[model samples]
Target: MKKIIYLLILTLFYSCTVKYYGYVYDIDKKTPICNVRIKTIDSLNITYSNENGCFEIKLKEKVKELVFEKENYQAHNLRTLSIQSGEFMKELPFGDTIYLISKNSKYSRPKTTLPNNVYKK
Candidate 1:
């Protein structure tokens, strides 16, 4: 009876957690993006991509979504249902790659000279 209870507990614990492995990339450049932050939307669990833009995250299986963020890149929200449904694989022929779009710098502008009188003040 003790063994049966232990097995049941183990199964329950195993079923509650899941691990995901994937890579981050630049959508336009097709290059790996390192140090991208990945976090579960419903949980505090978080991880970051390595130098190779690869990452592994372990979290509760109940997590429904994941958010990916990086500097100068548009944040992406990935639905876990798509992952489970194999939609991710269909999009990428290779391994899982989460592509991020680079954000255009809104402040980028040609340098302008200030008025000579204003500089003297």
Candidate 2:
């Protein structure tokens, strides 16, 4: 009975271990975006991107979805995130560079005044 219980406990512990992994990048610039805030969709377990725009969060819950947010950037959802697996006891690379679109990058075209309009011709 003791061995059975121990096996069950070990299985449960390993099964719940999850590593949230990804890199954040600027959608337009095509460069890594650092210091981006990443968290579970429910607002739990927050983490930030490193200088290389890489991040890994170890989680006990089964949160497969996350949101990346930053100032002057649009919030992004990594909805296609995968389920937790493996038992190497460490974070692993998942997929894709998470992209964030900057709100401050909006471009407004300058109005061009013709020479004829200035002379009132």
Candidate 3:
């Protein structure tokens, strides 16, 4: 009776979903940073952080690498993070707080830094 109800609730809470929530903010101000591009490395799924600097995306089970970029901010690379089977929500913080200042001309960009957030076809 009560045991069955508890199991049902637990199952419902742990069900897998194809959604992810992400956010970007100023390193110093802590204010929401809007218009950050969220590009899926492998697929064509693309999104932008809203004014509140938050975004939600749907993806299959795989490593997801989310890139946070802005015009004036120094581009910060974040490694792909894994999400659990029963848990669909995951948060990825950059190795260090990203401060976007002037651009670096001597920087060499890599073709790919992290694996795509979905399974390979």
Q: Write candidate 1's Cα lDDT for 39-100 as tens digits.
A: 98854889999998999888765456689999988788886654646554322132488888
Q: Please report the candidate that would top TM-score against the real structure.
A: 1
Task: Name the weakest run of 10 consecutive residues (lDDT summed) in model 3.
Answer: 94-103
Q: Write the per-residue lDDT of candidate 2 for residues 5-120, one digit (tens) a residue.
A: 99999998988878778788887787998899988877868999998999887788655467888987878777533445654333234756777888765432344677766867
List residue ranges in candidate 3 displaced over 4 A.
Answer: 1-17, 82-121
Q: Candidate 1: where is the Cα deviation over 4 Å?
A: 1-15, 82-95, 105-121
Instruction: Return the lDDT, model 3, position 114.
Output: 64
TM-scores for every candidate against the unseen true structure: 0.63, 0.62, 0.50
Residue pairs in candidate 2 whose N, alpha carbon or C atoms collide under 3 angstroms: none
Q: How close is candidate 1 to the true structure, as a TM-score?
A: 0.63
Each candidate structure's count of clashing pairs: 0, 0, 4
Segments in model 2 whose C-alpha atoms lie over 4 Å from true places: 1-15, 80-93, 106-121
Give the higher-lDDT candidate: 1 or 2. 1
- For each candidate, the alpha-carbon lDDT, in order, equals 0.78, 0.77, 0.63
Best by lDDT: 1
